[model samples]
Target: MASDPNTAPHLFDRALLRARMDRARRAGPVAFLLDRVVEDMADRLQAVTRGFSDVAEIGSPGELLPWPLADRFASITRVDLDESETLPLEPESLDLALSALALQFVNDLPGVLTQIRRALRPDGLLLAAMVGGDTLTELRQSFAAAEAECEGGVSPRVAPFADLRDIGGLLQRAGLALPVTDVDRVVVRYDSAFALMADLRRMGATNILIERRRIPTRRATMLRMAQIYAERFADPDGRIRATFDIIWLSGWAPHDSQPKPLRPGSAKSSLEAAVKRAPK
Candidate 1:
């Protein structure tokens, strides 16, 4: 059955994204961002004393996770990118699930997350990281300015990313408990805007929006974009800055062992009384 457009708005062209990823893999994937995220995931996992037996990793580039999880999980299943939406896993099969730097491209994030939640065992953990919140703001701004100047109008050049609060709500909507969200803002400097574009190409992170312009960007527009980027986002040292906000999200499947919130009207002390007891 066709998905309802209201619930599953198709923002990304998944086929194009897959092709780009294949091209990047053939050209030796430039995976600095993925590597960084994997390391952070490792550190976070260290804080949890419990061990996970059946774990699934989605969107992780080429063995980036195996090193950190070498002696850990009994089985590590790698979910293919094509199966991102369906997530071909049995219900309540996984003890842990993780995705790195990939969920942002999913067309139906809520549906995908619901699938993950269902696949997780009771009290199983779900940890993921995705780019969001002002990521590529410089490029988006530069392109908008340049396109408006050169083409009389602007087109969709960058993907819209979710914010921290939106992700937290998604976790709750997916029936995951104790939803926690955080951000890791990483600012990278490049010699020029063109250099940053090249890195994005190498990373296969170019615009694959469903409504993206089909024709090639005009040379004049490209040049003007570079000029505007330098003018607005470059530092005194002549390097342009790009911001990438990595939003980290973690939640657990509901279980009796987990703590539950108090009933709405079950508080012993009134708000006024609590305020009077506050440190002054």
Candidate 2:
């Protein structure tokens, strides 16, 4: 059963995340990841034969729809990250919904997707991209190893990411039809783990887990983490690798025109008969 949005466990510090985002915006966000996903989303949108007149972009740092996409929609609404749990739009109000590099921080992902599903019109579409799978795996492992050896234990350093199958299941659970999910893994090279950490701050993607260590990481532990990262994940040139897995999800509001699955025992021919008829 899906948990109530109001009572969902607080896995993230949303207030802190908001402040971090504000600071990153003031300093100019590191938008390479966002740009890449938006471009890919635009390409996907272009491939669809139909057109969307009304659209909403939820939880994006800034305007993401490019020129042609913006032109396609008669009206476009941009919702901030804080409002994702309870959307302002009415039921059946939107023909399309888009989100880029958001939703991962959401405490109740199923609740948010349910809200989005409610807002979409019959046959309306939802397209989103979020960090998931093995994103920042190297850093996460290095931190764990360093903390285990130096600090004697590991606290939550990086946020947990959902796998593609898990996301697909959420879409289905939210009453969406024909749900699809895929991953695009990106490997970034950095001179050191510190460089990667700096970029994460610039992207407003630093640690905000509710269980994160409130105190600063020890300097010795930090140094050891960097060293472990270099020793394990470094390339031929000595630069370390950081991974970001962008998981894409799409689903449509149920409609009669949409394809339906075959019912159990509905097949007219038996598998044995079909195999017998095949060429040797």
Q: Which 10-residue window in model 2 sums to the lowest lDDT? A: 80-89
Q: Across residues 65-98, which tens digit of lDDT does each residue of candidate 2 receive?
A: 8656678889999987683366787989999999
Per-candidate TM vs. native? 0.95, 0.97
Candidate 2 — which residues are off by over 4 angstroms?
none
In Å, residue 98's CA in model 1 sits off its true spot by 0.6
Assess the local accuracy of residue 97 in candidate 1 as a C-alpha lDDT between 0 and 100.
95
lDDT of 1 by residue, 1-280 (tens): 2233357888899889888888888887888888889889999998998889999997665564667564788888999657336778899999999999889998888888888899999999999999999999999999999999999999999999999999999999999999999999999999999999888888889999999999999999999999999999999999999999999999999999999999999999899999999999
How far is 194's C-alpha from truth in model 2 (Å)? 0.6
Error of 1 at 248 (Å): 0.5
lDDT of each: 0.90, 0.92
